[model samples]
Target: MALVGPLLAVVVLTAAPAGVKAGELPWPKWLVAGVVAAAGVLVAVWTPLVKARTDALAARTTREAEREAQAEAALGRLPTLKRKALLVRDMNDRALLGIHEAIPLPTDSDSDNTLSAELPTYVPRDIDADLRAALEARSRTGGFVLLVGPAASGKTRCAYEAIRAVLPHWRLLMPPDGATLNEMVAGDADLKHSVVWLNETQNFLAGEDCLKASMVRRLLADTTKPVILIGTIWPTFYDQLRIRVTTADEESEGGHAFDKDARGILELARRFSLGKWSDQEWDRAKEMQSVDPRIRQASLHRGQTGLTQILSAAPELVHRWEQAETPFGQAAITAAVAARRCNHPENMPIAIIEALAKEFLTDFQRATAKEDWLTDALMWACRPVHHSGGIAPLQAYGKNMGQIDGYRVSDILVDHKSKSAPIPDGQIAPDIWETLAESATPQACLLIGMGAYSAGVLGVARSAWERAANTGNAEAMAPLGVLLHNEGDAEGARTWWQQGADAGNTGAMTALGAMLHDEGDVEGARTWFIRASNAGNANAMTNLAGVLYHQGDTEGARTWWQQAADEGDADGTAALANFLYDQGDTEGARTRWQQAADEGNTQAMANLGVLLANKGDIEGARTFYTRASNAGNANAMTSLGMLLSREGDAEGARALWQQAADEGNTQAMTLLGIALDREGDAEGARALWQQAADEGNTYAMTVLGVALDREGDTEGARALWQQAADEGNDMAAQALRGFIEVEE
Candidate 1:
C-alpha cells in the first residue's frame, strides 16, 4: 500500500501538467489532478499478478500480528493449572475417533518462531524408565493398574509419580480434596494424552449412580484416556488389564483399626506378587498354627492367582491382617504338605502349619534364624502409631517413648537426637543391637551381617550362651552344646549336653545321644536316645531307629521309625518307604517317596523322580528329575542322562553323567562308565567302573568282574565276584555258583 501511494502521487503530478497542455477545455486543476490519481490507482487494480501479490502480503501481515499475540498469551499462561484458553480452537478438528477422542493439533500461532522466550516449561518427573518409554511410544495409552496400600502407605504418591512422568510438558493436575469425578475427566481433550489423577477415589465411588460416580464410570469405561485413581481404599475397574502397587498402612491409625490395617498389608504381601516374602516398614508375617482346627488341614494355597484376586476381591482382606511380616509363601507350602499329610497320615504326617514354617525358612535361605527374632521385635515396634490425620507420619525415636500410644506427629519427628532423619548409624547400631541382645544374644544377631556386630554375632553364639550357662541356666547350656557340635568340637558338645540334660533340657538330651552314637558308645547312645525320644525329639527317635536296624533289632527299629514318622520327620518317612519297598509295597513306597521329596530331601526326590518315570509319567518325571538334579541327587543325574539319550541327545546325556561322576557319585560313575563303553571307550569305562567299585557299588563290582573276565583274568574276576556277592549282588552270587558248578 505504501509503494502504490507514492507511485500514484508521482504519476498524478506528472499527468496533471500534461493534461493542461493536451486538453483545450481541461477540467479544473484540482479535478484534473483527482482524475489522474484515480487512473493511476486503476492501473494496478486490473493486473492479475499485482492483485495476487498484494493479497498475499496482506494475509502474511495479519498472521504475523496474530502469532505474536498468541505467543504472548501462552507466555502469560505459563505454569498455570488450566491450559492457555485455546482462543483459536479449531472447529474442524474431530471430537472423537474410534474409541478415544482425538487430541487437537497446535494452531499456526503455536509456531516456534513466534513463541515467547519468557515461557518457562516444567519437566516431567523422573520415574521407572521402561514404563516411560512405553507410554511415550503409545501417545498416552491409558490403562488401569490397581494401586493398593494400607492407608497412608504412599499409594497416592506412587500414582502421582506415574502421572508426572508421562505428562512432563503439562502442568500438574492436583485435584482439590474431595473433588468430583466430573472435575477429574473435565479436561478430557487435554487429558487424552495426560492423566486424570483422582485422589481419594473411594469416597467418589461411595454413592453409586450419583453424578460424580457416573462420570467416573464413564471415564474408566472410555478406556482410551489415562486416568489414575488414588484412594485410601481399594477399587474395581473391570474388563481391563491392570497392575497393582500394594503398600502397608502408614503409622497413624491407633487401636484395632491400625492392627487391622496391618493385617490387610500382610494379606497383600502373602497373596500377591508370587508368594515371596516382602518386609513392611515395621511388621512381620510368618506362618503359625491357625486357631481354627478345620483350617489347620486345608490345602488351599493363597496368592496362587495373585493379581487376579486383587482385581476381584482384594477389599475383603484390607483390615484383618495382624502380623507385621505376613508369610505369603507359606500358603503354597502349606497346601503341598496338607495334601500329603491327608493322604498318608502315618508315613507322611507333617501338619500344614509345621510344613509351612519349614517352607518359610527354606525359601529364605540367606535369612538367619535370628531374623525370626527380628521379626518379633519389628512387630512390637509397629504397635499402632498414636496420631491420626496428622500432617506428617510418626517416627519412633529416643530411649523412652514412655508408653507411646499417640504423640504429636511433629513432636515424634523433632524429638529424636537426629531430628528423625533415620536413626544415626552410630546410635541405631548400638541401640538395635543392644535391644536385640535382650532376646537374641549378639552371637546370633539374625539380621546383622558381618560388620562391627560380627564379633558379637557370628563368632559369639557359644560364648554368649556360655555366660548364660555359667549363670546356671540349663536351657542356655543346650544351645551352647549345639554351637560346640557345629564347631566340630564333639567333646565340648557332650559336656554341655550332659549338663543341660541333667537339668532336663530335652534338646540337650538329643545332643548327648547324637554325640554318644558318633563315639560308637551304643549303650550310652541308646539310653540318651530313649530320654530324648520320650521327650518328643523326633530327630532322636529317627537316629535311634537307624542304629537299632543296624543291630538287627527289627521290632525296636520299626517301633521307633513309626514313632518318628508319626511325629512328621521326612527322614522317618523315607526310611518307612525303604522298608515298604523291600516288602513289595510299590504303591506305598511311591507315596512315601513323594511325601519325603516335598520336604526337600535330595535322596527322596531322586527316588520319586525315578519311580515316577518308571510308572510312565514322563513329563512329571522330567520335571522332578530336574528338581532332584538341582538338589544334587546323583541317581537323578544318571536317570536324566538316560532320558536325554532316548530323546536323541546322547552327547548332552554324557555330559550330565560326567558331572555327577566328577562329584564322586557311585551310581553316576557306574552309569558314566556304561555310557563311555557304549561310545567305544572301554579303557575309560573300566577306569570309571574301578572308581565306583572302590566306593562299594555292587553293580559296579559286577561290571568290574565282567571286565576282568574279558581281560583273561578268571581268578581275578572270581575275586571281584566274591566281593560283589558279599555286598548282596544276586547276579554276582549266581555267577560264582555257576562257575563252581562248571568247574566241578
Candidate 2:
C-alpha cells in the first residue's frame, strides 16, 4: 500500500500536467513529497557505510592469504632442524641407531678410538651359551633373557653385540626412563621384531612403587608379541629383591604385596650372570691387537696388569727405585697401610701420607733431601689420569696432589683368609709401631693406634690410644671413643667423645653428633654438627645437610651439601650428585660422581660406573668399578665382574664375584652357582644355591626346586616349592599348581 501511494502519485503526475497532477493526486500533495524526500535521504546515508565494510573484508582476506604463503615458505627452508626435532621425539627414529648417536661415550685414552670396532669383535664368554639357548628356547615358549652383572661388566655391550649377530637388520630401542618405556610399549605397534634393551635395569626395580618393574612384568606376560627384551641388572640389587621376596612375613598385611611384585618380576625372566674379564680373556683381548696402538702399549704396561700382578710388580718397582739399603721403601709401605685404614684408602689425604713419611725420615735421622725419600715416588704412584675437585684442600693446596690411586696397595699381601695381617713392625721395619707409640706424642700415638688397629692388633691399638689419652690428647681421646663405639659401648663412646669434644677435637664432635642422631636427639645432633662444621669438618657438614633435609629445609640442605662437596667430602658429593641425577641434570651428576669416586668413595664409584655405562663409556666405567672393587666394595666387584664377562673374561669375573660372595653378597653367590652349573659342577652349584637360599634368596630357592624336579625328585621339589610359595614366590606357586594337577 505504501508503494501504491508513491506509484499512484507518480502515475497521476505523469498522466496529467505537472501543475494539475499534484492537486488531483489520490494522496495529499505534501505527504507524497515528504515520502519521496525521506527515501532519497535513506539511500544517500547507507551507501558509503556498506562500501567501507566491503573494502575492510577484502583487505582482511588479502592479509590472511599473504600470511599463509609466508608461513609455508619459511617452513620449507627449515626441514633439517624440523626433521631433527621431530626425530628426537619420533618412535621410528629410535630404531637401528648406534650407541654413539644415542649417548656420549668416553674418550679418555687412545683405546677409546677403537671402542666401536671392539664392540663388533667383542667375544662373549660365560653367558653366551645360556643366552643362545634362551634364544632358541624362547622361539617355542616365548620368554626374554636378563643378563645380570656388575656396573663395569660388559652386559650391555655383549647384549648389543649378540643382537648385531642374531638380528642383523633389526632395530634397537633404548628408552631412557620408565615413562618412555611405557609409551613405546603401549603405542609402538611394530614392536614384535625389534630388540629392546634396558641397561642398568635396577633403576626400574628400586623403590616401593616400581612402575617400571610393573610395566616390564606386564610386557613379559603379554604373549602376543615375539619381542625380545634384554635387560642388564646389577647383581646386588637383584639380590636385594630376592631377599625381599624370600624373607617376606606371610602373615604380615603388607608382606604379601611386596612379595607378589618381587616374585612376579623374578618369574617373568630368565637370568644370565656375567663377571669380570679373566686373565685368559685379557690375553685374548691383547691378541686382538686392537685398532688403537696406544691401547696395546697400555695393555703391555705393568700398571695395566691384573690387580694381583700389579701389586706384585710394585715391590719390584720399589726395589728398583731404591737401590740403597735405606728404609724409605719400608716407610712408604707403612704409610700406605696406615692410609688404607681410613674410611677408605682414597680418603687418606696426600698431605697425611706425606706427613707420615716425614715422621719416618725424622725418626731415622736421614738427610731431609726432597729426592732421598719416597714422597716423590709415592706422589707419582698416587697420581690419577684425571684431576678431581673432591680432594681435601689440605691434600691439594700446598702439594696439589691429585686424588690417590693407591698404586693397588690394598691388593698387596694382606691376609684375606685369616683377616689378621701382621703388624707394621713385622711387615715393614721392625719396631715402627712400637717406636711411634713410645714417642708419647698425640699425633704419633694416634698413628700407632691406627696402624695397630689395621693389623688386627687391637690390644696394641688400645694401649697406644690409652697412653695418648692419659696425656690428655684430644685426638687420642676421639680414637678411644671410636674404639668404644665399635665395641658396642655407646655410653662409653659418648663419654670419651664428650671429653674429646670439650678439648676442641672436631672428630669427636662429629662422632658425638652421629651418636646423638642415631639416638633420635635431632636438636643435640644439630648443635654438635654445627660446632664441628664451624671447626672445618667436611663430614660434619655432610651430616648437617642430612639433618636439614630431614627437617624439610631442602634449600638449606642443598647449601650444606654444596659446602661439604666444595670441601672435598665424598658423601656430600654423592648426595649432591644423586640429587642432580634425580632432577635430570645427568651431566652435572656425572661430574660430581666422578669427583667423589676419585676421592675413594666406593658408592660413588659404583654409581659413576652405572652412569658411564648408560652413556656407552664402557672403558671409563670399568676403570671406576675396578678401583672400587679393589677398595673392597662388593657392589663394584659385582659390576666389574659383569664387565669382565662381557669382554669374554669369565675367570676374571668369577674371581671378583667369589670375593664379593665371600663378603656376603648374595647376588654374587647366585651367579657363582650358575657358573658352577655351567662348568659341570652340579653338586657345587646346588650347594651354593642352598647357601644363598638359606640366606633368603627366593630366586635361588625357585631354581633349586626346578632342578630337583628335573632330577626326578618330585618330593624334594614339592617341599622346596611349598616353602617358596608360602613366601609369595609366583613361580613356586605355579610349580605347586602344576604338581597338584599331575597328582590328580
TM-score for each candidate, following the candidate numbering: 0.43, 0.37
Candidate 2: regions farther than 4 A off: 1-461, 484-494, 502-504, 513-535, 543-557, 680-683, 686-744
Per-residue C-alpha lDDT of model 2 across residues 1-744, encoded as one tens digit per residue: 111111111000000001111111122221121100000000000111234335545765775565455434433332233353222123222123222111112245545454543222344455676687676566433456788764335566566666655655544555544445544443333445546656656444432123233345445545566667767765645664543221111111111122233334554577887765576666655765565442344356533433222212333333322332344544454454444332122234444455555555554345655564555545444442124211111122223466442232322222111223323322434344444455434544554565566455666677777886777877667767767666777787789889888888776787787777667776676677777765556667666766665455656666767877765565677767765665577799789878767655676787677667656788888887877778787767766776676677879888987998898766567567766776778898888879977887665676677667768999988898788778756556777787888799
What lDDT tens digits, residue by residue, belong to model 1 across residues 88-199?
Answer: 1211111110011111112333333432222111112222354445445444444333344333223344344444556555333333322333433433323443343344
Off by over 4 Å in 1: 1-483, 551-556, 646-648, 680-683, 738-744
Candidate with the greatest lDDT versus the true structure:
2
Give per-model CA RMSD. 40.0, 33.4
Q: lDDT of model 1 at residue 744?
A: 85
The CA lDDT of each predicted structure is 0.43, 0.53
Q: How close is candidate 2 to the true structure, as a TM-score?
A: 0.37
Error (Å) of candidate 1 at residue 351 is: 42
